[model samples]
Target: VLFPGVSIDECEAFTLAFRQLSLSGLADCQVVGVGAVRGEVVGIGGRRDVEQTFAETTRPDVVLVPGGIGVDRTAHDEALLSWLRHVEPSCQWMAASSTGTVVVAAAGLLADRPAATHWLAGAKLAEFGSAASPERIVEVGHVVTCHGRISAMDVALLMILRLTNRQIAEQVRIDLERAHEQAAVARPSWWKRAVALVRPAPRGPVRPRNEQLDTSDWVEMELTAEPSSTTPNGDF
Candidate 1:
């Protein structure tokens, strides 16, 4: 994994997303940093998962780069560029999240390739010899790219689905959806909800399958938020 000053969201997303693969027992592999120290990675508030893992002589089958201000800085790094160019031939797959595309594109690997990147980087793709994609995730053979940090979640889940099956991805969707629900509040989608004869939900990813607070749980959660906001209709 490329973690050259990656966004904390990107890094943590990559890390927490492993719960599904690990839970489903699909990814029979581990994570390692290309140029990271063993104890502390100095990016995105810092991560401890990517330690001195280059102990074996084996090369990674896949490489994923997450984006941030660090990626912008690394885009001009001759050392990183040279390494990417050298390793690409031996890699079975490669991908980037958000501005990490800038770094990968800097290595010349994306030349003439169709890929998606952080929207802010749309103008920069032409500079790197790659085509911009209309989709959030784009794949041309073994090389893939995701548009942004949140979409990076899709990248990881999609990889799990490809390497394993749909069941695992569904399970991951459940976990991720639950996490997001716990983290924020959102608006409902009245149109889609009306189609199903259900109430609208939020603007983000759909709630996990088989999930929705029961009447009692809903009331409890509602009271926890703002006791006075709770009404007979459960409107808040």
Candidate 2:
């Protein structure tokens, strides 16, 4: 994964999904985060440490470029663009998410192809000669583009399906979802707990009537009822 001004949410989505695949024994894979330098790269949500610098990084089967506020500056980086151009031929799959599509497009990798990006960046993506798509995941040849940060998990699952099989992918998805649900139940947010405490208990189920009333009896009773003068309306 390329960490140039990365969106931590997107990064985590991809990494966590891939990690689940590995942890579930569905696939054997290693996800490495790379950057221009060796240490930590401050990103949108948080900072992440890169395992390798661009120079030390080996050829990866898959390359992921994540988008963030730093993309404006990273998009203009000739070194990163040059590096991406160099890696394209060797990479089996290339992916970008959100504004990262702009960086890939800037690298001249998305030319004349349809690519997915954040809705707001469609016009910007078109500036690089690629047709921008609103689809959550767009697969054109070996390149995959995700529309937004949340779509990162979709891309990861797609990769798993492609690399492994539908069965494994489905298993991974179920496992991740189960884990997420368990986590939510295990440690709910303060607001959720507060709401639960103040919430009224559910009402008991209604008891069945011992005897059913006839519709004719109800109509007769309504017609025979006396009107109350205390109601202020003489007609009742």
Candidate 3:
């Protein structure tokens, strides 16, 4: 995964999780960075310090870049854009999250594709000739994208689904507690029944065993033990 610049959320969302689940095992296939700027940016520390100006890294089967302030700045960077251009042809698959789509779009890679990006930058996506949608995850050909932060998780699952099968994706969904929020692939009208068969129905709410407490049923009273005064009342 080549993050144009370091972004902690993007690293956590894709890189950390990919390390946990990828076939190459945790230590073998590591997440590398190609830093666009010099200064440190919080949690996104020294991953792969690309001190030299943007140049294509090793050819990757999958290239992923997630959105952040990094995307906003990297869009106009000539060298970074040049590096992306070099990698585009060789990458088997490419994906972006949130505003990172802006960088991808600016690279002319998402043209003629249905892309997803932050609602705030929807127009920016269009400016590059990509069809931007409000959908959580949009996959046009080998390119995948998500519109915002929460959809980062969805983009990861979709990548897994594409590489594996629906069954594995379903299992991962259950394990991640993401089945309820998993984005659905549009199916043919006839296949809708098949989709229904695979997907469980929406869960019904759990009912409480007890009824509401009625405040009116409760009583307020004031009582005094006046009789306890006994002989004391007669005496001074």
lDDT: which candidate is best?
2
- Measured against the true structure, the TM-scores of the candidates, in listed sequence, are 0.65, 0.75, 0.60
Model 3 stretches with alpha carbons more than 4 Å out: 1-6, 23-28, 36-56, 70-72, 165-236
Give per-residue CA lDDT, model 3, range 1-236, as digits (tens): 34435455665565433443443231234445654554334434334443323443646655777676655666876666777778778866677877788888899888767688877887788778886786767877888787645466556555554554444444554544342233233334667678768985465533321111111111111011122223211100
Model 1 Cα lDDT, one tens digit per residue, 54-151: 43314566677777765556788776676677667877667787788878888888888767887778767778888678777787777778776456
Q: On residues 56-172, what C-alpha lDDT tens digit does candidate 2 reach at each position?
A: 775877788888876667888887888789888887778898888998998999888878888878777777788778566788888889776456777766666656555666677
Ten consecutive residues with minimal summed lDDT in candidate 3? 214-223
Off by over 4 Å in 1: 2-4, 36-39, 45-50, 53-58, 70-72, 175-236
Name the candidate, 2 or 3, with the larger lDDT value: 2
Against the unseen true structure, what C-alpha lDDT does each candidate score? 0.61, 0.71, 0.57
Model 1 scores what on Cα lDDT? 0.61
Using lDDT as the measure, name the better of candidate 1 and candidate 2.
2
